[model samples]
Target: MIPDMTIGQLTTEASSRWGEIWDPRATRMTILLLCPRKERKMMELHGDMIEHGQPVMAVFHRPRAEAHLLEEQGFDPRAASFQFVNIATADMGPWMQQLVNNEGWLRSSIALNPTPFSVGLPSQRPFEAVQTLCFRHPSLPALEQYFLPYPAESLPGKCFVSLPRRAAAEMARQQAEVLGVGRLEKPQPPAPEPAPEPQPAPVAEAPSESQETEASEAEEPASQTPPEDTAEPPAEEHVSVPLPPTAKPDPAPAQAETPVPLPPTPGEASTESPAEDAPGDGELSGSENIDLPEVVEEAEEISELEVELRAFFQELIDAGVEPSAFMDDPRWEDISERAVAEGLETWPILLQMTAMG
Candidate 1:
C-alpha cells in the first residue's frame, strides 16, 4: 500500500532529484515515489533512464505530512513540480490513478498538465486555464485570483469542484482523450531574419580654395566680354530755358512762430522732456526684464515635466508593459490625462521610441 505524503514532500523530492533533467520539450510525465532516502539503486536506475532521454521521471521522496514540521526542517511547503504533456494525446488520468492504487513502492504522487509554452519548474498553466475558463463562463468571477497565490497541485481538487457541471464534464472528456493517445510533435515555425542595419549616407566633399580660384579664373573672361546686342544711345541736342526771378519775403514770416521757453514753476527745478526719461528702442524696462526671467522659468518647467513623463513611460516598458495597453490600465489614467493636457501623443510616441531603441 502507498503511504501518505503532503504536497510539500512530493514537490521537494521531485525538484531535488529530477530538477536538472527537467525538459519541457520532451518530458511527458513526472512520478514521485514516496520511498526511504536509502533507496539509492532505484534512484540510480531512474537517473540512467533520464540520461537516455526517456519521457518518464521517478523521484524518491521522504514523506513529511505536517506543514510546521516540514518548515522547521527548512523545507518549502509551496514548491511544485510540473511536467509538460500534450492534452490531445497522453493517457495521463488512468495511468496516474493506477500508479496511486497498485504500486506499494510508490508512496505518494501527483500529475500536472503543463501548458504548451511553460518552461522550467514554474507553470502558468493553472492561472491561464482558469482565466480562459472564466471567459467562456462569465458567471465565474475571475477564478484565477484564488489559485495564483498557491502551488498548482495544492488546489487542484478545489479548482475542479468550483467548475460548473458542463465545464467539468467537458474537462473530463478532454482528459480521457488526452490519456488515450501519444502526442505527435508539431513542427516549429522558423525564426524570422533580423533586419539589416542602415548604412550612413556619403557626404560630398567641399571644393578646395585652389579649385574655387581656378573655376573663377576660367569664368572671368566670359563675364568681362560685352554682349553682341548692346549699343550706346545717340547724343541729345540741348536747348537752355529763360530764368524766372525768386521772391525772398517768406523766411521772415516763419521766425515769428518760435515761442520763448516757460520759466520753472514754484518749488520745482526745470527738467528735460518726459520722452528723454523713457527706455531706448533696443532696451527693456524693469518690469519687462522681470517678465523675461518668468518666461524662461515657465519654459524650463515644461521641459522638466516632459522629461519626467518620458521616464515614467520608459519605466513601464522596462517592467514589460506594452505602451499600447497603457490606456487599459486604470493605474495609468492620471499619467495618460497629464500627457493629453501637455499635448503629448502618448502611446504612439512611446512606440516610436521603442522602435528606435
Candidate 2:
C-alpha cells in the first residue's frame, strides 16, 4: 500500500530511498526544478535570499506542455505567470491536508496554486513523479491573505516561502514595468492609396508669327499702362534756385510759366512697356500646372511619423519609463531619425535603450 505521508516526509523518505547525500548545514541550496510559471516570483525570492546572505543556485524553466496547458485554462499565456489560479481549500490533496490539519505543525495553509516542480538531488538524479508528492517546508508557509478558491483539476504541491512584503511589492512593480515595455500588438493595415488627380489639358502655342505678335501686343498694352480713369501723375515741376550774386540774371522775355516735369523715382510706374511677358527658354509657361499629388504624399508621410512617435511615447509612459528621459538625451533624435529612415518603428528603439540600461 502507498504510504500516506506529507510531502516533506515523502521527500525525506525519497532522499534516503534514492541514496542522495548532501550537507544541510551548507549556507546555500542548489535548487534545480521545474517552474512552469511564477518565474518572476521565484526570481524575487532568489534575490531576497541573496540580500539576506543566503546564496542560492536556482534554475527554472517552463515545460512546453505546461505553457500549452496554461493557454487551455483560459489564462492569457503572456500574463499567466503574474496571475493566480483559484483552488479549493479541500482540494489541497491528502498529503497537504494531513500536514495542514496537524495541530503540532504551526504551518499556515493558504490557497496559492503555484506551479509544482520535480527537483534534482545533490547527485543530480531526477525525481520521477514529483507531482505525486506535496512538500510543505516550515520555512515556506502559505500566507492567509493570499487565499483563493481552487480551480477544477488543480492540486497542491510544494509551497516555498514568499519574499518579504516589501520585497514582493517591489518585484511586482518591476514585473509590471517590464511587461508594459515589452507588450506589442498587431500592426494596422496600410491606408489606401490616393486616387490620381485629373491633369490639366496642355495649352497649344500659337504657331503663326502674326498671331503671336497680336497676342504679345495685346498682353503688353494691358499689363504696362495704368487705366486712364485711375489717378494720373501730376505735371512735373522744376524749382528754380535763387541766382548767385556773381551770376547774370536772365535777360530773355518773361513768357507763360510752363511746369517742368520732375524725374520719376525708381519705384514709380513707367509708361514704357517691356519687350515681352512670354515665358523664357528654361522657365515654365503660364499654362503649366503644379503636381498637387506629390505635395500631398509628403504631408501624409510626415503625419504618419508623428503618429508613430506619439504611440511610442505613450508606451514608455505606461511602462513606468520616463519618456522625458529619452527625449532629454541628445542621441534620441538621431536614433529616431535613423529608425525612420530605415522604415522601422520607434518602440524597438525605446525597448533597446531599456534593455541596454
Candidate with maximal TM-score: 2
lDDT of 1 by residue, 1-357 (tens): 113433334444644534443233442422322223343344334322222322232222222232333345453433422121111114334333433454422232222223333223343434332211111111111111221223333322211001223433455566667786444667999999999999999999999999999999999999999979968798897999888987666554444567789987754543544455555633655556664434444444446556766777677778888767755766577876787887876666677768865
Query: Per-residue lDDT for 1-357 in model 2, tens only?
Result: 122322233333433432212223433211122122434464335334322211122222222333544455443444323222111222223323443465222333233233333322122212222111223233332222221122211213333332334544555666777788544667999999999999999999759999888989999978988867978799999999997688778799979999999976755534322323233522564336555554544543555554566565655666786755757756568758866797877776466656655
Clashes of each: 4, 9
Question: Candidate 2 has what TM-score?
Answer: 0.16
lDDT of each: 0.42, 0.41
TM-score per model over all chains: 0.16, 0.16
Q: How accurate is candidate 1 locally (lDDT)?
A: 0.42
Off by over 4 Å in 2: 1-161, 164-173, 176-192, 195-201, 207-210, 213-357
Which runs in model 1 stand beyond 4 Å of their true positions? Answer: 1-27, 49-52, 55-357
TM-score for predicted model 1 compared with the true structure: 0.16
RMSD to the true structure for each prediction, in A, is 45.2, 52.7
The CA-based lDDT of model 2 is what?
A: 0.41
> Weakest 10 consecutive residues, lDDT, candidate 1?
132-141
